[model samples]
Structures are given as structure tokens and as C-alpha cells.
Target: MENKQRLIGIVLAILGASFWGLGGTVSDYLFRHQNVDINWYVTARLLVSGLILLFIFKLLNPKLTIFSIFHNIQSTIQLFIFSIFGMLLVQYSYMASINYGNAAVATLLQYIAPVYIIIWFVLRKKANFKLFDLIAMLLTISGTFLLLTNGSTHNLVVPSSSVIWGIISGLSLAFYTIYASRLLVKFPAILVVGWAMIISGLLMNFKAPIWQFSITQLNFANVSYLTFGIIFGTAMAFFFFIKSLNYLSAKETTLFGTIEPVMAIVASAFWLKVSFLPYQSLGILLIIILILTLSLKKEQER
Candidate 1:
């Protein structure tokens, strides 16, 4: 039974990674190949996904109460912020950065999240200040740097604005991880995620004048993108992620998550012709090593 559960956990983790991988590559497709604007794509993500999940909840568990979901207003707000700032902003800003700079640089920069999380923990005094953590942090940063520099230049040449914004994206992710863990301890994870999506969708509607809501302009192509984003990218991936959380240790879960960027690299390489510079490849390798080492150490300590 233990082995069976572990196998299920492994499958869930892979499914989660696969869905995330699909989401990342699909973002490029919607933007470049399909001519779908990022704004529209985000808006569609919120609306379509939220509604679909709501219907699923209604059908599967009719006793579920919307009022019950609202009982933890603070957690709900944090979850919504997770969707808006953590997920939505990251997605939008990432696309913007790539457009402003290039995908290679943008991706390398956005991945600076692990470092930000360390900083976040340090500032909050939640994590022990240890030499290994510091070394791991340095390794993560160096990896990101190597990825960007492609092992070519001693001096990094990233724009200050892109760097700053990328850090903000990482900050948001750090907050999401910390806060989501806190909230999940007290509430149903699905309610937290679903309401968060609804709020995020509403927030996106007001963020810009992107979703025109024109039935006339809607086409099969755009709908196709929308369907893919909501179903495959948002709902299914999130479901598997939550399910995996139920069966795996957090350390095991995150180790498997390394699969996401790997999938990103593979898809980008195959479809987008995005290749790594030697430095960039070295950096990615280092980051993976750091995560593996630190995570394993933590798990053993526990």
C-alpha cells in the first residue's frame, strides 16, 4: 500500500508538471502563433476556468456552499491575490519581458524565485540562517546568472527594469508559497483555489481594457486557445497539484516540480528553437543541483 501510494504520488507529480509545461509553451503559442494577446489570454484564463470549476463543484458536490467558501475571508483574499499577483502578474509580466527583451533572458530572470523565497524567509525570520541555505541561495542565483550569460560574459548585461520586475514576480511567488501553505492548513484547498480564480478573473477584467466581450469577434481559433488554457492549463494542472500534495511529502513534491522548467526547456527548444548558451545551461544545472541538495537535506533533517 505504501508503494502503491508512492506510485500514485509520482504520477500526480508528473501530471502536474506536464500541465504546467503545457501552460508555459501554450503561452508562447497563443501570443506568437495564434495572435492572441496576453491580456485576452489571461482574462480568458480567469473567466472560463473559474466558471468551469464552479460548475464542476456544483455537479459533483451539490452540498458545497459558496457562503462556506467565504467564511475565511482573509484566506480567500490571499488566494485571490495568489491568482492575481502571483499567477496573473507573473504570466503577464513574463510575456511582457520576453517581448521587451527576449524569451531566453526573460525566462532566466523570472526563475530567480527560489532566491527571492530565501530572502523572504530570512526577512521574516522563519528560516534558520544556515551556511548551507546561503550556499544554496548563491547557487540558485549563479545558475540564473549562468543561464542569462550563457557562460559567455563575466559581467551580466540585463536591463535594470527587467531585473527589478522579474524579482517582483519572484516575490509574488514567494508570498504565494508561504501564504498558500498557511491558508491550506485552515481551509479546503479547492475552495481556496476556485474562489481565488474567480476573484482573479474579476480582477483581470478591471486590470485593462483587453477582454472586449464581443461575441461577434470570437472565433474558433481564439476559443481553442481559451479552452486549452482553462481546461488543461488551469483546472487540470491545479487539480493534480493539489492531489499530489495529498500523497507526497513537500520535499518529494518540489523535487518533482523541477520537471516544469525542464519541460519548458524541452518544448521551447523543440518548438520555439530556444537554445541555451553554455553559461545558461550551466546556470540551470546549478540551480537544479542546489534545489536537490537543499531539499534532500531538509527532508533528512525532518
Candidate 2:
């Protein structure tokens, strides 16, 4: 049974990662071809995805009240922070970065969150300030430099604004990881994430209501992109990833997640026909490996 479970877990992790990876490509497609509004898509994605996950939570754990997380004032506040600061920031910054630049570039920068996580641990005194952490940090810095410059200061590979938004996305991803840890301990992962999605969606909707937006053409191509962006990219990918956690450890899940940027880059090169700098790809690869090593060490210590 254990072996069977592990096998299932491995498959789930791969599928989850693959779906997530493909999601970036789909978003890139929409941005390039469909002229979909990034804010509107993010809002709709969050609303639909959150409601679906909430429904799933209700079905699986019928006894627990769905709104029970709000019973406590502290939990409610934390949930608000998670939704606005964490979810909203990460989703908006990431997509906006992609809009300004490309999905591959945005994703590679977001992977820098592990470096921020290491810094948090050291500052919090949760982990010893190891020499390896410094090395990992250096690798991340060097990787970013190489990716952006290819060792040349004269030319900027990505737009300055895109880099800023990508960094913000990375920082926001780190924030979500830390902020959500508390709520996740008290509630189901699906429920916590679901609520965050709903809250963020609602907050975004306040500024740009869904009803205000309309499709000018309403063609099949645009419709497919919108559906895939919400249904596959945002919702299903997250659901599969959370489900994999039931059988696998967080470290394993994250390690598998490295596939996302790869998928994004390859799809961008294929669909968008943008060639990757060999040095940039190499630098990103190094950063990914070091981040994995950092996570591995932490998991081992646990």
C-alpha cells in the first residue's frame, strides 16, 4: 500500500507540475493573441477557482463549516493579509510581469523566492547561518545578473519594469508561503487557498468589476484561451498540486515544480519564437539546482 501510494504521489506531482508549467504558456498565448485583460483574467480565475475548491472542501469535509475560519478574529485578519498581500500581489505581479516581458522570464524570477525563504529562516533564527546558504544566495544573484545581462552591462535583456514586477512576484510568493503557514495548520489546505482566492478575487473585482468587461469579437480562439487560463492554468493546476501534498512531502512537490519554468520557456520559444540565451538558461538552471539543494537540506533536517 505504501508503495502504491508513493507511486500515485509521484504521478500526481508530475501532473501537477506539468499543468502548472503549461499554464504559463497558455497565458502567454492569450496575452500575445487574444488581447485579454490581465486583471480581469486574474479576477475571474480566482473567483471561479476559489468557488470550485470551496465546493470540493464542502464535499470532502461536510461536517466542518466552510466559514469556520472566520469565527476567530485573528484568523480572519490573517486571511485578509494572505489574500491581499500574498495572493493578490503574487498573481498580479506575475501576470503583469509576463505582460511586460514573457512568461519564461517572469517564472524564472519568481523561482528566486527560495532564496528569500532562506534569508527569512536565517533572520528568524529558525536555521543556522550556513556557508552553503551564502553560496546559494550568490548563485541566485549571479544567475539573475547573467540572465538579465549575459555578462554585459550595456544591454538589458528584459525590460526594467518587467524585472521589477518579477522581483515583486518572487517576494510576494515568499510572503504567501510564510503568511499561509499558520492558516494551513488550522484548516484544510484547499479551504485556506480557496478562501484566499475568493477574497483576492472579490477585492480585485471592487476596482474592475467583471460585468464591466466584454469580448469585442467572442471568437473560438479567444474563448479557448480564457477557459484554459482560468480552468486549467489557475484552478486545476492548484487543485492537483494540493492533492499531491496528501501523499507527498512539500519538498518533493516543490522539487517537481521546477518543471514549470522549463515548460514556459520551451513553449515560449516554440509558440512565440523567442530564442533563449544559452547563458541565461544555464544561469537559471544553476539557480534552480541550488534552490533544490536548499530545500533538500531543510527537509532532511526535519
Candidate 3:
């Protein structure tokens, strides 16, 4: 039974990561070709995906009340913080990065979240700065430098705005990972994620009013991409990832989640005809090694 469950988790993790990766590519297409507004896109994505997730949650666990997370004052505050600073910020920054750059670079940049997690732990005195941690940090810095500069200190391969947004996305993701884990101890993953998405979506509406925006390039392809991004990319991706946690350890799940950037890079290359310089490719390899090293270290420690 345990082996079967683990097998299911492995499949779910791969599918979830693949969806997210391909979703990034799809988002790139929309932003570059479909003339989709970033604000409107993020707003609609959150609202629609949140609604779909909540519907699934209700169907899967009808006895559990979704509102229970709001019963406590502290939990309510944490939820709001998670929604805005973590969920909303991650989503917006990621999309902005993709808009400014390509999906491959954006996804690779976001993969540096584990480095931030290491730094946070060190600062909190929760963990010591070990040799592996130092190596991971160096790898992250070097990889990012190569990726941004493409091995040239004199020039940047990507826009400065894209790098900034990508880094912010990584930071927000680190926060999301840490804080969401805390919340998950008290609430189900679906409930917390669903509410977070809805809360963030509602908050975003004040700034970008999805109802007021107009898409001039509305076509079948655009609509299909949008629908796929919302349904498969956002809703199903989150659902599958969360469900995988039921059968696998967090470390295992995250290790599999690295497939996200790989998929994004491949999809961007073929589907969008994006190209990476040789040095940038090396940087991507280093970053992947860094992630694997950190994940393996954590697993060994456990």
C-alpha cells in the first residue's frame, strides 16, 4: 500500500511540475503574442483557479468547512499575509518576469528559492552554515550571475526588470513555502491554498479590476491558452502537488518539482523558439545541480 501510494505521488509530482513549466511557456506566449495585460491576467488566473480549486476541495472533503481557517484571529492574519505577500506576490512577480524575459530564465531564477530558505534558517539560528549550505549559496550566486550576464560581465542578456522580478518571485516563493508549511499543520493544503488564491485574487481586483480590462486580440488560440493556463497550469498543478504530499515527504516532492524549470526551458525552446547562449545553459546546469544538492542534503539529514 505504501509503495503504491508513493508511486502515485511520484506521478502527481511530475504532472504538477510539468503543468507549471508548460504553463510558464503558455504565459510567455500570451504576454508576447496575445497582448494580455499582466494585471488582468494575474487577476483572472487567481480568481478562476481559486474558484475551481475550492469547488474540487468541497467535492473531495465535504465534511470539512472551508471557513474554519478564519475562525481564529491569528490564523486569519497569517492567511491574509500568505495570500498577499506570498501567493499574490509570487504569481505577479513570476508573470512580470515572464513578460519582461522568457519563461526559461524566469523559471530558472525562481528555482533559487531554496538558497533563500537556507539563508533564512541561518539568520534565525535554526540551522548552522554548513559546508554544503555554503556550496549551495555559491552555486546560486554564480549560476544567477552567469544566467543574467551570459558569462559576460559587461552586458546583461536579459532586461534588468526581468532579473528584479525574478528575484522577487524567488523570495516570495521562499516565503510561501515556509509559511504555507506552518499553515498546513493546522489546515488542509487545499483549503489554505484555495483561500489564499481567492483572497489574493480579490485583493488584486482593487488594483487591476479584471472586469474593466479588454483584450483586443481575443481569438481561439488565445482563449485556449488562457483556459489551459488557468485549469491545468494553476488549478491542477496546485492540486496535484498538494495531493502528492499525502504520500511523499516534502523533500521528495520538491525534488520532483525541479522538473518544472526543465519543462519550462524545453517548452520555451521548442514552442516559443527561445534560445539560450552556451554560458546561460551552463548556468542552468549549475542551478539544477545546486537544487539537487540541497534537496539531497536535506533528505540525508532527515
Angstrom error at residue 254, model 2: 2.2
**TM-score ranking from best to worst?**
3, 2, 1
- Tens-digit per-residue lDDT, 144-263, candidate 2: 888877777798788888899999999999999888888988988889989999999999898777676676756888788778778778777888888888888878887777777777
Better of 1 and 3 by lDDT: 3
The candidate with the higher TM-score, 1 or 2, is: 2
Total backbone collisions for each predicted model: 6, 0, 0
Using lDDT as the measure, the top candidate is: 3
Candidate lDDT scores, in order, read: 0.67, 0.83, 0.91
User: Looking at model 3, which ten-residue stretch has the lowest summed lDDT?
Assistant: 293-302
lDDT of 1 by residue, 1-302 (tens): 98899999999988887777666666766666666666766676766666776676667679767557557678657666677766667656766665444444555455556667767677789777778768877897677667655565666555555556556666666666666776677766666666776777677778654447567646887677566666887787777876797789878887787676667667777878866666667877886677567556752431
Angstrom error of the Cα, residue 258, model 1: value is 1.3
For residue 177, model 3's alpha carbon misses the true position, in angstroms, by 1.6
Give the residue spans of candidate 1 off by over 4 A: 57-60, 72-87, 98-111, 152-164, 208-225, 299-302
The stretch of ten residues in a row with the least summed lDDT in candidate 2 is 293-302
Across residues 1-302, which tens digit of lDDT does each residue of candidate 3 receive? 88999999999999999999999999999999988888988998999999998899889989977789999999999999999999999999999999999899999989899889889999999888888888988999899999889899898999999999999999999999898877989988888888999999999999898787665667899889999988899999989998899889988998898899999989999999998899998899999898788767644541
Candidate 2: clashing pairs of residues: none
Query: Each model's TM-score, in the order given?
Result: 0.83, 0.94, 0.95
